[model samples]
Target: MLKGGCRLNGKKRCLLPLLLAGVLFSCTVTFSAAKKIPTILVCPKTLDNSFWGNVRAGAMTAGKEYGASVIWKGPTVETDIAGQLAIMEDFVNKRVDAIALAATDVKALYAPVKKALNAKIPVVSFDSGLDPDPTLCLIATDNYKGAFEAGEALARLIGQKGKIACIPLISGASTSILREKGFNAAIARYPGIRLVAVQYSESDVAKGMAVAENILTANPDLDGIFAANEPGAMGAAQAVKARGLSGKVKLVAFDASPMEIEMLQNGTIQALIVQNPYNMGYLAVKTCIEALNGKKVPKRIDTGVAVVTMDNFYEPKIQQLLYPAGNSGK
Candidate 1:
């Protein structure tokens, strides 16, 4: 009988080293399978709105395509800067393989994003971005250009000469900041167009409507209105409808929500400056994976935009961009 390594048996002796080898092989296979899939944490600015839901869908799609795992979470509202920062810190603490973030406040989120980068986790920013460029990629629409187009569209609707109001979703949001500058720049191009009032909605739906109402009341002779985001557009549409000024005072807004689409269909909204949010979300995750794989990713990736109205909203080509989730025929 082999004292330590063998079982004394009448016939087939079992060796301890052979049994140990089999156990080691099984563990090696299990560990390798688990390590094959990289887990990512995606934190958008807000998940309550449909816009962010589309972003989440895109990220999830990318995750499936790349054989990666994703954990999607964010603040319930876009203005919750502290909450967003806390989420980022928590993801960092969890040691996620990568992170995709949409910053609620650029400067406020900078420190946490930087901390994740310093901790050697790759980060990507989509939609609104973080300052200091801690992200491997910044995937976003050309907000300034889109807003300028919206301004020009409004200017045309008002004969390029009238007192107009600018309603922005959030005063501190990076997208809002760019859109404001763009709208202002476009309005200045025409000597006749005057940007009279600028009121903030703080990214709240009700506040958007209330602010719009106040702007209209304060300027009874206002000719046109430009809403800089989905909520702003929605509120502005409601305000315009409630005042019975639908066709009289043109409303040009950014982003296309179901409500905004219905507004366009009914002539409450004249024009919509739309962005490829799905593309932004998908590319952001793709870039993060690239960075994690030791591949070079571009610092800036621009998702394109389009201006949609009732006249062109149903075009087959446009539907793909506006409804990437296979709603083209609907």
Candidate 2:
């Protein structure tokens, strides 16, 4: 027996064959309709750091778990707003199932993100966010609270009285703006502490080092420093160490990269304000997939942060937070 033909629709087909009397039989048996595996595009601020690397890992892990094809792409530097915008727009035109973006600039990315929304593509903004957010959901750390905690930690290390300077990531980024404000707000609490100089690193390590060196030179008696991101932190640490002011000028930095961790162990960086980048990346893709599946998704998801210091660095939970493998999609 044989069927005339098989109709291929939005379903999967399995063929069962039978042979008898030198005759062959074929039948198209359909299982429940197969769902299309979605292709999700994940764009972080930059493709050049361990933070974004962790995010990529988390996103890929989610894609594997949820039957999605994940495409990771971003600009080479975090300051390349135009580059990131072009990338997003290209993906939108390609009609990828969904887009997970960690915008380079808060306002600059709104147009393309809005365009994606208009095209019926779900957008999930993570890390740095979009202003007038048109995305389906935002997954990020509480940058303000983390920076405030960093300020408080620096204040305590300097014994609540000293000249301190700040090196924020960049001026236009939401993360930069919030962290700078939060640190300033915390510093305002104590009349004895004076925030002497503030500079923008533009998320460049050499620039961060140069900025810190200038600040230290201007205020020879500078007591402490707060660096708001990884590049800034690394640069500040190098500056502090080069001047042989390792433990003298207390430094509290954000994100614990390998260099920062080495600095922490050697008394170059006093504390690290760490975010769950892995969790952030994982949740972003998970949310995008959910939206594509016609499932309800939350408007906001806080991946949270931790203030890490020598006193609690070895704790199991903190260790897991610092290492990506210990806490992927958990």
| Model 2 segments more than 4 A misplaced | 1-35, 326-330
| Weakest 10 consecutive residues of candidate 2 by summed lDDT | 21-30
Best by lDDT: 2
Give the TM-scores of the predictions, in the order they appear: 0.90, 0.89
Question: What lDDT does model 2 reach?
Answer: 0.90
Q: 1-330, model 1: which lDDT tens digit per residue?
A: 675556467233465567789999999999988786888988988887677878888888999999889899999888898899889898899899999988888789899888999999998888888656677888998889998898889888999899999998776788888899999989898899888899997777899999999999999999999999888888889999999999998999988777887898899999989888887778878888898899999988889889898778889877887777776535
Model 2: per-residue Cα lDDT over 179-265, one tens digit each: 998999999999999999999899999999999999999999999999999999999999999999999999999998878888998
- The whole-model C-alpha lDDT of candidate 1 against the native structure comes to 0.86
Global lDDT of each candidate: 0.86, 0.90
How many backbone clashes are present in model 2? 0
Clashes of each: 0, 0
